[model samples]
Target chain A: MTWDWAISVLGILAGLCTTGSFVPQVVKAWRDGETRAISTRMYVIISVAFVSWLGYGLVIRSWPIVIFNVLNLGLSGVILFLKLRSAPPRRKEA
Target chain B: MTWDWAISVLGILAGLCTTGSFVPQVVKAWRDGETRAISTRMYVIISVAFVSWLGYGLVIRSWPIVIFNVLNLGLSGVILFLKLRSAPPRRKEA
Candidate 1:
């Protein structure tokens, strides 16, 4: 395969890894009903970043970029929303 | 600007956010000295993914991809290492 095609494929595969990394975080937090351990600020920043990715994907007309960011936006957005909705984690005993 | 250039810039911007997202996670986890709250499996997977990204970047000759994944690898790698080194979180009371 040509270099461009090869890298594109590799990029997609790498993106898939980064993209899917959030799955367990969301699934476990949602299932456990406690997301206070997660950092709201981090996720908020990430969500905005995903939006940026979305814009880039649209500009490039790249389906993988578009779809990846969309899913990430949803996953991170939900986590942020949950964090906002939930009470903070309690302090551990001294 | 042409579509390719525009998207490249946008992608760089987006990639920055995603790339940096691990910063806070790493810092907080390290400072707090408690990564049990963070999923070890998620990070192990992500670290492996970052390697894939590194391979992809190397193949593509893209500095952005290479640098991004390198930093990500270090960040995630540290978190994983810490998580492995630390004990699990204590059980919460009913």
Candidate 2:
């Protein structure tokens, strides 16, 4: 196999591992209502970050980056929404 | 500007944004003792996820991927340790 092919395979494998990691968090949240454990700002910021990466990937047409970011974009967005929905709205303070 | 250069710039910007996103979580955890909210499994799993990406990036020799993963690896490690340190240990279930 060519070097580029090997690298692509590695990227895909890495992407799968990282992507899979979020599944447990999602599951934990669903099963235990663990969304409270996550910070709303974290999820929101991460969603934006992944969206930027998704845009970059689309522009460069790198499937590895594109695929992972696309998947995570949806996942992070849902997580963010869930966090916001479940958490008490921040109180307005002087 | 050349297409490749533009893509690289985009990738870097995306990387920075994604990398920056975690700062809030770390700060939140430190300031609010918010580690109670985070699932230990999430950080542990995500750390492994990024380590895999780091390996892939190193193999592929992609500087953008490598740089982001490296920065994130240290950050994630610190966060994971903090989560473990601050949170109460899981009980021995019958």
Candidate 3:
């Protein structure tokens, strides 16, 4: 029982750290209005990944996973939006 | 059995997507040699999170989590290294 509790705490800590990490990125993007060094593809892929994680969490009935993924989705989405908005113009199609 | 298999696939997909997402970020930082827009705090926290996740995976005997977190650690580490190396000099004390 003690081992299980310890593992659970670890999982929660991991989830919180991963999810909260994005907050700084979002804040930086929002504040500086700069994302040139950030990768659009990375955020795009990660956003999709968060959705997949959320689904898995739901299926597994893990509240920590679900909550963290939801938060991740929001934070990552903000970064993606900022990146896209600040992106340079592409070549015009004929 | 089918449901379990499907769930496993989803979990794998989630792991792959999240782990693979960092590739573009690392590539961008490497190619551009500019991490001005990247958040140092975010990477630092995320790296720790990856370590925590790795520990949890090991405790749970979850190969998927272990594999993905290891990949994440490597990728996120590269980005963090670049970001720190490129960071502007702090104000010097008199």
Against the true structure, whose TM-score is highest?
A: 3
Across A5-88, the per-residue lDDT of candidate 2 in tens digits comes to 887777777777767767766766766665654767777778877888888888877887898898988877767766776787
Write one digit per residue (lDDT tens) for candidate 3, span A1-94: 6999999999999999999899999999999999999999999999999999999999999888899999999999999999999999998999
Backbone clash count for every predicted candidate, in the order shown: 0, 1, 0
Cα displacement (angstroms), candidate 3, residue B29, comes to 0.6
Candidate 2 on B24-65: residue-level lDDT in tens?
788777777656556667777778778888888788677777
- Model 3: share of real contacts kept: 0.89
Off by over 4 Å in 2: A1-3, A34-37, A90-94
The DockQ values of the predictions, listed in order, are: 0.52, 0.60, 0.92
Flag regions of model 3 displaced more than 4 Å: none
Across B1-94, the per-residue lDDT of candidate 1 in tens digits comes to 7767877778888889877887887777778876544666678778878999899878767899899889989988987887788865679999
Scored by lDDT, model 3 comes in at: 0.95
TM-score, every prediction: 0.82, 0.86, 0.96
Worst 10 residues of 3 chain A by lDDT: A62-71
Tens-digit lDDT string for candidate 1 (A2-94): 878877777888778877887887777777776644666678778989999898888768898899889989988877877787856679999
Question: Which structure is stronger by lDDT: 2 or 3?
Answer: 3
